[model samples]
Target chain A: MSDRLSISVRDLFIDYEIFEDRRAAIRKRLVQHEGTGRRLVRALKGVSFDVFEGEAVGIIGSNGSGKSTLMAAIAGLLPLTSGDVLVSDEPKLLGVGATLMPAANGYTNIRIGLLALGVSSNEVDMMMPQIAEFTGLGEALDRPFKTYSSGMRARLHFAIATSVHPKILLIDEALAVGDQAFKKQSRGRIDSLLGEAGTLLFVSHSLEQVSSMCSRVLWVEQGRLRADGPSDRVIAKYEAFVG
Target chain B: MVTSPEPSSGLTSVSEALSTREYLTAMWKRREFTIEVPLEQLRSTHQTTLLGNVWHLGNPLLFVAVYYLIFGVIFEVNRGVDHFLLWLTMGIFAFQLTSKTVMGGANSITSNTGMIRAIKFPRALLPISVVISQLLSFGIEMGVLGAMAILAGVGVSRRWLLLPFVLIVHTALNLGGAFIAARLNDTFKDVQQIIPFIFRLLMYLSGVMFPLERLLSSLGEKSWLVPLAELNPLARIIDLYRWVFLGASLTGGHIAVTTAIPFLVLWFGFRFFKAAEWRYGRA
Candidate 1:
């Protein structure tokens, strides 16, 4: 694939407030006091990165290190306190326990998922069988989603998320849930997705997997980018630091 | 890969949110999601009940029946309004639609945090879908009200054609209200609890169960309450419905104000809600 920038996140900042008590928050506001009952956690602090087309990049970070928040901000799921995210197209976020209708069967959830991704109704019809096949749920595809095991649910989510072939895809530790066979199938699907010049930002805890699959690795430390380089070089540093 | 052009220099102007036109176009494209998700939600909402979908119609009917018992049967507070049943129906149904839409819209964002973070779609669709869901329920309730009106000596007339126009204006107002409510509720959790009480007070002021004209005549035309009661879009829309459905007297000034207020509120509400589109998910 040619080297064209597909995703650029510049000086991004995201913070979330924890409201410990509902009444306290209300009282604090009414009393005209600032920071009396709320705590602001800065999840991402002026982080910046760039991804080119067809690049498979893994984001590695310690817990509370803002890996997921960075992915979410790129997808426009989180509000930015400052900075900018320039993208060629909307980024699809693939995460575990996505809110597909639980009462609806797997097949219906597939249809809903496709439509939510802005797939046309006719396209949804054309894509349903393909997704259902990939999910490999067979007869269980007709059963309610709540009836599925966690592994099955993850498989279905991965299948539906990949069905649209988004130009930019963000996977947030979703692959960590499924079994070995499903994981193998998902890796194959992601490979094909990247083969089409799509950009991928994968957040995972597995260093070995990141070292193997990713061409580049970004190590995020306390809401900032500590290192960005070749996978082997950065993962080694990350491992040494953690160990 | 060879070194690429500096991304920061080339993409520095990229704002955090989509442009207004771009956002609306994208939302229009994914309009199907707005309908499909909410319809499925509405359908599954009552599956556990023995009565199921019947509760949609039954709940509104039960509510109207309680009001009727108090004002119609017990106190006989008809207040010379012809076809009191139909008047009450129009007022209650119209008022209820807006109230429910506003409250439902308020909860839309908070209830769907998982969906918001999982998929990429215009967050506005959530509030829009809530309005649609409530409108669907209102449509069915209107059908039952129509049947009841027919049996109560109210005849269909050419004025009935204006009902569509009334509904269009009412929906615009509801859409705008939903947008504002959705954003406020996301910022302040206390707003959700306070909304129902606010709507209850609106129900009394909007003349949902009683006639505003009676109150006006007693309070005097020059009283400050006259304009307050007359200018409220809910009251005006309910009055427009009464004018068409029950042949009640409605002034041209009232019609003009009712129609104009909805569009104005719609424009303001859409802009107000759009300004905060980026903030819906972070909290």
Candidate 2:
């Protein structure tokens, strides 16, 4: 209900009810004993956070600590099972970074990726040059995406995903996949975007990245918010916890 | 374990919340969606090759010959069954949608884990794109089957108009299977292994290469499979194809189930896919 905030969550939760086997599920009504008393796995539990316009936040957590889930929920990919996730702008969570239809080439993937992202054709065409440049994948851009190296795929994905310029940019471990050179360039590019007042939520294991890029830090664990404050305070706690 | 109380104001109820139709209408005007034209680019990128676009035709034709040679000529089932290619082709073509929908569609979510994790477009579009792309492949195969049907003295009839309608049902069935597969594939990689085998069993049961008459005569039509054989969901689709193109009846029993069951299956498939629509994006 807070329209001023870019993203506001009040006790957001995501719990999945894993059903029985398909055959058992089909025969469930007819059969008396189909097995019961199993508890659901809660992936995200009563978690809450807020991101306003011009806020660049970094989320850190141990593996399986729900960093990705929190990002996905904010991006609207995952619906909250309980509570609320209110967003004032569109959110883009970088997935597969850059996806290529193995059968298709890089240029092809760019269009489809944009479309898959639900971009307008005119907008995709407009951003094509900028996307191609950011990838730095020159001559290889004409080749099939499958033929490109992982670095190239990541580069291509990062470029196309960032092409339209997202409002709520939620990047999950993007820098972790790229090479040092690409990572260096990625940081600069991201910082420039942040300067332009874009709200970002970056989830990464890299402490240096958390401290350098984000204004605030959010430490997540077991699908709950563990700590939220200044970058130094949270990263120190997270690093300590990991150690 | 802490339980979430039910949402206030009965938001879970279908009528209380924004209906899908209403939301879609609102979206068209406001949302500036980017359509991923992966297909056009994917096809164009590979256009320079020798087989060029012919490879699309060549692959399915090769499959048709392989199936016909193995199941038809070598096995002598061609002589045994009437309209051998027609029947065999029907099964392959009909099941192509199912196989692709089940096999390809199931992995749609798991395969696009990166996309699922990143963006907030319709998750349904991922499976839909798969089915549509596969449908393009099926179109090529169907053309081959249609040509063969023409050569066998079966010309196009008015019934062919229903092809689009049947195709819609076929799409619905694939979409439903895709929804289930997209979610199920997340935990079980084994689903991928068993899909081809399921298609093979269904092919034989649905009277694809072998005729339903043979199954009926040998197994006795009234046996447990009577419903399956008589109603034969797949066989009906093929019959509809043959009846429209080849201008032949695939038996009255075949037509009965084809006309009735597809609609039922389609309805449920629609409901099933929609119910799990949001879950797909998350998975």
Candidate 3:
């Protein structure tokens, strides 16, 4: 599978079957599976793309333009109503609070977060200091993540997620949180990750970050690809589209 | 990386490193999370409220006492099962797990819109934590129930040793229910609104107030209701507590029936949560 394609998606479509309620759902079964009055909302329509071994891609779109939808479809979080996604790696999604249990301590959250990202116990132990040090929380590292401000929390999240070194990292608006200082620190670490042959699908609003971080950019509009090419041109088109 | 020189690493053996795949390999991994944040919040979430840690044991004890007063003294139910106080207390203690999970789990995901909108991890853990956190409370209530059973006049059976298994099943049932309800409530906010009504219906159907069989023989053969009635995982669990100290019998199809709901709830809940995991943070 690694011979050529790193991630392959073909004509993906995601549709939600909205039934009125459970009672209606049960009653619909009484009559027939059909005519349940279920309606389908197409979140992603015929989205097709590929990311090679070391490509960094940016997915840009207005709210509900299917940017997150496309990323999720590829991450296997949402099953496409009609399409296929094949990847050489198990993509780890690093969205804010995506899988992190907030009630746990930064220490325990790291363990759970690492596990969700597909990391093991021993490795997490080894990576612990590096993540803690990079997060720059110092004694705060020992505190509950909830105690830390949003920026502090994001720093820890960035450190732990990058520590595992995923082959393909799916980031959704995680960068938008945190303060300017946190951003600079996080960006430095993330830059180091991208330098090492990891393919990333970053979904964000900052045009500056998109142009700076991505090798290529894809703009989605109302569940369809509206623009695809170099980050500069795509961002420009996306800017106009958003306007 | 915003600056984007590209990352490159060599030399270190990543194989020896922790892989997320290995972590999620088991559906039920009992290890504590490896983080420094949630623990403080969880502790504070519990402690910041009045009564501190005492509430864990106090709340459930209070609930059991009320039921004991109502069932054992006020109305005076419980035909023949012996040690009516112990029986009523234990049964109420056990049944609350379902009611709590139903009410709590129904909105486990929906209620945490803040978390749902921001984070992503094993969604199952949300419901799992709700149930597990109550373990201490259950332990305290169990002690009170056991002592009461002995005082009320019933012989202890060696077979009463099987109580843990029932507790596990009860936990599983709660986990499963929460899992399914978590996902359903996400799509339908109204699910939370109707929880009290459905629970009331299930309350009578599952026999929380009295021995279900005594109410009517017509209920005996209703195979569909049998699972909820006899093996009522909750009732079976409480009865086991009673049987241990009071010599109650933990028999019948209730266990077998109740068992099925957990596994079904688990399977579907997992799939449903996974299906929506990606969409959660999006607008």
Candidate 4:
């Protein structure tokens, strides 16, 4: 990795105040004299890391261990309870269930998504064919997005997010639903992204995928950094703990 | 040549808010989103229906007819108004734009949680798109109102030229309400649930079905409330439209309040929405 700091996270803390159901919340306020029915969840606590340019750092953690939270924080999508995140440029985030206009067809969604990314209408028209080819859903592109399977939705979301060739890409389990063939295609896309000296922060439970694509890995456990080192070394420890 | 630059030399804080100038520039760059998405939404609004886009015109006509039957025939609330049907149509069409815009704005952020979490654009576009889409719908309804006015013998006068100006003022009012509602609903989803009731109450208070003068006269000794009702921005907006289409009388005071309040609300609403920019989609 180069010495150029692509992303710098310093002492970041994120707390989620999840509200209870309305009926339960009302009962708690009335019977137990609770002021509010919010339960605080410390998703990230004093977590800090610096990612260098051209580095593909993979984050591994158990479910609800804040791997996704850290990805989101790095993407600037989450509000930090404390601390700061500094970046060289805006990062593009791609996660499962990230959709636009569910009622619109896949083609329409792709066009809208590109436009939302600030691509002019002319550019979107020119790029439509290539994006459509990449999706590999020729006939299905006419169907509404809400009708797409999770794998299909993931493919469309990934294609649109990576369309503009983002300098910094933060991916959270978006590839988990793709089939073997799609995974291989996306791997080639990721390699081309890296070849351009792009920085990537990938969060996934697949140690194989992480080790294959990333040179370095971070292991987050229960809202704290458990390990940060080379991919093989960190993966070994993570596997020993969770395997 | 061998000197190394500091690692954090050119990095910018990711979570900091952009300056107003920068924010507006970014929004302008993405202006197509505010237009295209809403146009797509409007196109698909009746896609599933048998009658398809025809419902756009048909629905508003039916709405005016139903209101005329109830208030004009049954309730006799059309007493003081000449051309009761046209007046009622004007009021309903104008007021519906604001109500639909505000209600749509209330859910704009909440419903688009997926888009908000996925992409980084000016979040204001969501509510702005709602207003645009509602405005397009209002345009279709206005066409229906125009045809009805002609059939009802309301001639096109020079006052008709002011329709566009009045509509712009009304849009400013709708946009301001939209921004405020979007932020409020994002923070507390209960605001969406309560908005419809509030607008229903407003419809009555704004004299959407009857003449405001009659309501004031009916109020009799409640002289204090007369000025308050007269100052209701929605009433003034409807009055402005009525003046444009029906050649109804309008006061300078009404014109001044209608023009000023919308812009003021828009300024405040923009600030209010931007204040919570980072907090949206956190839930």
Candidate 5:
């Protein structure tokens, strides 16, 4: 909520190496060269931005525009090719494909997911009831996660991810699958994260949701920050550009 | 109107390698995660099996039995070694432990690719946890080894107490091997396919089924292959276990080689593993 910087991404660049074939990828390891078959796809190019504490910033971009890559970079999940990403705290990323064991039941996943996210075992037990209620899978929680419908899976993931009240939350389109009731509940959770003065970086294609929920917006174009300003201004510019 | 943002003083840039202190501290904090996952997996491993946890005991027993038939009954490969059954049992168990630990560790990171990308925990925990799980299974196999030792007319002696000491050294060696395999497999993936073949060759060279000293003496003491065989840490571990359990006397030189090799491997493997910490998930 204060003016302190939550995240500072300075001249950040991420290069994804594309191997034309499996042999090329394996051979590159032995030879230590790009070889003719190896190509570097720069996912984020000289991108720089600063997010203040308690600010909810929506990163809007078309597919392959580096929205998820930027979020992953900020979460310290991706390897940066050049430049720096400085964060006040380790950001919790709630991607739709967040790490849940498909083979395990929902209850087991809740324990493991929370544990993976660094929640203490004792706290995991205490948080179980609330997480169970929020996800509302009920008896279905006993079945394997792979058996759950995609919507059910997303809901469970969202509930477990929000259970810890992260200091900085990075959500990459995890909310897109939920129904109206689930959305209402998640909206409340987001508001609570905001109430606790937590910083939020959301990557979503839903312009209406982004415009309403975020105070500021960032428009990424082909790995570059094309626009950054108040939500209305940036969204207007983005719409005009697209149209 | 928007103004250009200031470069904040709080910015802390990330480098390729985390400091040793920071990395260790982070690992220590998530120590429970490392410990719990393996325990959970072991519990669920045979939950649906009719024999349940008995398979942990049964599987190794069955494996050792087949090797016992081939090497003990048919080939009489245990001819020179006293208490052949006990000797063969120890060798197979130790060999199995090493192979399992290496193979399991090799797959640890690559197998959990999704989790690594989804969560940002210490990457080292993957291999560390693999070693721990294998150690747990090894503990159970040791009990079966003890039963087999007694059945073969070997009694408990002061030398048996030395089993724990050997175990500690052997564990260090396994941990080191696991670390190396984990890193190698993350990159080459061919490392996994090649591991079984490599271990198969090692099994013969390391004297897992037969007495190396008997073969070495037959080939002449001064033979270069003798020292080469002595250099293998797994052979030394197997010989060390046989010495403690079956009362075989390994030469002073052989004992020295066994003791020295594990520590050396541990020192080298750990540094080699740590140096590649940042590359595990990314690669």
Candidate 6:
């Protein structure tokens, strides 16, 4: 990894307000004349880190431990309750559920996805063959997206998301789907991306996958960072704590 | 072999909003999304129906015919306008565009939570695309209206040339309403449930089935209601359409008001929507 900083997180905090049902909320306001039926969830609390250029950092945590939240914040998808996340370039987030249009066919979705990422229409046309080949969903590309199997959908989403080679890519459990062959293929793609000096922040539950793909790892517990160090060291610590 | 740009040396706060100039430039670059997605939606909208695309023409025709039957035959509410059916057709067609756009915009953000969370784009495009699709539907309806006017022996005139200008102003008004509704619905979720009733009430007040002049004259004692009905933007838009199609009377004051209000609403609505830009997909 280079000395140049690619991402800097300065005590980032994110709070999600979970509001009660509208009808219940209205009833409560009328009856209680006080409670708004809103609860604040502190998804991230004063977490700070700095990622250097060309670094592949994996974030690991138990369920609801803010791993996904941190990834989303770094991707600039979440609003900050306090503090800041600074990035050198716009980051693209690829999650298992990142969908474009469910009714549109896979080809149409691929075109719109690239267009949404600010790719020129002509470039989108040129990239069609490459994206189509990567999806490996030939002929099935004409079928509506809602009809795709979960693994098939993940393949298409990953192919479209990585089509433009974003300088900073944030992934959240997006590689867990698909078969062994597709998994190997996707791992190859990720390697090629990192080979180009791209920065990645991958959030996954698989310690083995994280240790294999990332040289550095961040362990988050609850809403705070528990550890940040070399992949093997952090993984060992996280494994012991979990056990 | 497109080489990716080197990572910038300097880091900027990710939560901060883009400058207006930067935002506009980014939006312009994605203009194809505003056009193509709506066209695709319009294409797929009728895919499940047996009649397919014919519903685009048939839907509006059936709508106007039903209203003509109720207001024209049963109630005799045409108010003695020349070519009463054509006048009612113009009013209903124009007003439906606004109502449909507003209704569509209400759910534009809420319904597309998946795309919003996955993609980072100007949320304004959601409401804007709804307006474009509604505008396309309006165009098809206007084509049918034109054929009806020709068959009914309404002579074409210079005033007909003003139809596009009037339609543009109407679109601006629809877009403004859409932006405001989109943001509100994103926050409350109840806005979508309430919008249809609101539009139904607006339909009667906007003179969709009857003439505004008739309402003004009938409300002689309640003279206060005159300017209110006359100033209703939807009423004015419908009146403008009537004036274009049937050579109906349109005053200079009405023209100025119709042209000015939409732009004002558009400016305010854009600001209102942009204020909550970062908060859209939190749910």
Q: Which candidate number has the best DockQ? A: 4
Summed backbone clashes in each candidate are: 0, 12, 51, 0, 0, 0
- Minimal lDDT window, size 10, model 3 chain A: A1-10
TM-score of 6: 0.95
Fraction of native A-B contacts kept, per candidate? 0.53, 0.30, 0.11, 0.72, 0.34, 0.70
Q: Scoring model 6 with DockQ, what do you get? A: 0.52
Better of 1 and 4 by lDDT: 4
**What's the lDDT for candidate 1?**
0.83
Q: Which candidate tops TM-score?
A: 6
TM match of model 5 to true structure? 0.93
Q: Which one wins by lDDT: 2 or 6?
A: 6
User: How accurate locally is residue A70 in candidate 1, as Cα lDDT from 0 to 100?
Assistant: 86
Error (Å) of candidate 2 at residue B266 is 2.3
DockQ of each: 0.52, 0.26, 0.13, 0.55, 0.49, 0.52
Ranking by lDDT: 4, 6, 1, 5, 2, 3
Off by over 4 Å in 6: A23-35, B1-9, B221-224, B251-253
Off by over 4 Å in 1: A17-38, A146-148, B1-16, B220-223, B251-253
lDDT of 1 by residue, A1-243 (tens): 555788877788888878778788878887867556888899989887778889999999999899988888887777678887887767888887776678888888888778777888889888788888899889999888889987888888888888878878888888887888888898898888889998888899988878777989999999999999899999999999999
Clashing pairs in 6: none
lDDT per residue (tens digit) for residues A1-243 in model 4: 677788888888999988768768778889999777778999998888888888999999999999888888888888888988888888999899888999999998998888878898899899999999998878999999999999999889889988999989998999999998789988889888888888999998888999999999999999999999999999999889986
True contacts kept of 1: 0.53
- Runs in model 4 with CA error above 4 Å? A21-37, B1-8, B221-224, B251-253
Q: At residue B214, what lDDT does model 5 achieve?
A: 66
A173-202 in candidate 5: lDDT tens per residue? 988888888888888999989888889998
Interface RMSD in angstroms for candidate 5: 2.6
Candidate number with the higher lDDT (3 or 4):
4
lDDT of 5 by residue, B52-78 (tens): 888877887787789899989899887
Q: For every candidate structure, what is the RMSD over all alpha carbons to the true structure, in angstroms? A: 2.7, 6.2, 6.9, 2.7, 2.7, 3.4
